[model samples]
Target: MRSRRVLFAVHDWGLGHATRCLVLIRALVERGDEVTVLMAPSPGLQLLKAELGQQCTFYPYPDIPKPLGRSPPMFYAAMTGALPLIWARFKREHRLTERLVRKHRFERVITDSRLGVWSRTAPSYCIFHSLRQIVPGRSPAIERLVERGQRRLLKPYRKVLIPDFAENGGLSGDLGHDPQLDWGAGRLVYIGPLSGVRRQNVPEDIDYFFSLSGLEPQRSLLEQRVQAALPRLSGRIVVARGRLDAAGDQEQKGNATIYGYLDRHAQAEMLNRARLVFTRSGYTTLMELAELGKRALLVPTPGQSEQEYLAQFHHERGHAWSTTQRRLDIVRDLARAQGTTGIPQHATADSVQRFLDAIS
Candidate 1:
């Protein structure tokens, strides 16, 4: 088989999409394909660059502006207000994608939740977990409209690759498996969970590990909460402040250590060594936790219905513990988190290799 030139684009919503693509990117590079990443100069993209290094090329790409607000209600309101801007950005992304395809002459295009980044010149694929985009309130008409719009947006892609299991009811609950928003058979490829974290057979020395990420004011709000709670918690605490653009700085205060960011290896090691962890309930983080067999206290980003649902879904299933930012009683919740079984670590090496083969 001959090597193909691949162009990959990721949405800059949060670090999850970009981090999850690391698995695919590494696989493509290791297979001797020329891979080029089209992403904004965001923290997630920066982290990707550091991880991929010389294995792939990078290009500055356009991204939609983040919906901003201090709280959940405000966030939803801001998202509603930004609809026109988001639509305009989508159009711009289409033009930019076309231009990149012409210039780079890519043989394949893979987008992680970036709707407009596909091309007719290449075999384009969209890798996303969400089929039904859940909002705060449920409206039959709104749901139908969302489904229809999603279907139209995905039409340019060769296939929508869901990074989840087809069997075992999937990892993403209703987000990935919803009969109402079905995209028909043969349209989706269940690629299992794509995660880059490698587990180590090490002793669990750290009592608590806080993996902080996402767009802020929420991120900042969580940071403040964690900082306040740190004094009350005992044993070694490690905080990986997911700031990719910042320097790799570390600060040690007695039993607690905070780092600006951790590479894939450091993250894996820290997560593996921790007895209990605290992190956002992002899909990628959940996948990583499952892959490593670690349990966490999940605080879903406010207004993000998907994350909120995931947090509750896992909690109900005894997979993990969850609490809102406003009601985060750290000491009490950590004790509660200790008892819940984590999301089952079921992703095998065979499934991962099959995922690579599908793209190849």
Candidate 2:
């Protein structure tokens, strides 16, 4: 194949989005394609920039921070109130995207969770595991409305790329959810789970491994709460705060240990060595733990319905366990739970390949 250019518009929600896209971008570059990663300037993006090398171009896109609220409805309402800013960001990013597309004549545009990057003029494909926007309660009417937007969102792109198994929507199939909810005929494609690190046969001797990531107050608040309860947790514990500014190193705190951050390699090393992993049950994290064959105690952010639903969804399947951020003591209960996921997979989620293949 001749050399081609591709623009990857990554979502700025959390580290998971850009972290997984690292594998995608590397795959494209390995296959002799010029790739540019356009996302809002973010700590996660900065982390990615450090690892992805200079061949990858960087462009600023919209970045949304986690909102603080008491409930899912309140959180969504707060986020919804930011619609004007969201639209403005998309407008600005889209204009910048157009300029890049025109200047570089990209052969294809691949967007991961970032909508509106799919342009009619250029071959474009969308990569996402979420379609119907997650909401509280299982209302068919709301699902239909979200399904409509999801379908419309699918229309601008040439293909829809999903990063989960085709069967049972991987781990997120249940809970009034359908991978095919808005997926068009022949347009929906699954590329396994996009994973950067494989499960190493390292020692699983450590106790509960907690990965705290969301945003400022929420993240710091969780840290303080966990730090207060640290005295109670038995065995060795590791709490990662996912801070981007400081140097990522290991430190011991009585029986508990804290790491400011961990790149993918260090993270995999730890996950392989951990007996149980704790974190928000986001779809990507769920798949990563599954692929790594690690048990987890999920603590979803209080108000984000997606994490809450995902936590419940996997909890029902017995793949992992879930608890509200408030009742983190359930982690003690989780210590009694045994491993659930059957086996580890060597597969990598090639959403990037599927999108490129679609455009080609």
lDDT of 1 by residue, 183-247 (tens): 76677888788777767889999999999987877887888888888888889999988776554
| Candidate 2 Cα errors over 4 Å, as ranges | 64-67, 174-182, 248-250, 339-346, 349-356
lDDT of candidate 1? 0.84
What tens digits encode model 2's per-residue C-alpha lDDT throughout 74-135?
Answer: 77788888877767766666677788889889878999878768665787888877767666
Q: How do the predictions measure up, each by TM-score? A: 0.94, 0.91
Give the 10-residue window scoring lowest on summed lDDT in candidate 1.
346-355
Positional deviation of residue 325's Cα in model 1 after best superposition, in angstroms: 0.6
Clashing pairs in 2: 39-61, 193-349, 194-349
lDDT of 2 at 143: 71
- The Cα error of candidate 2 at residue 328, in Å, is 2.5
CA lDDT, every model vs. true structure: 0.84, 0.74
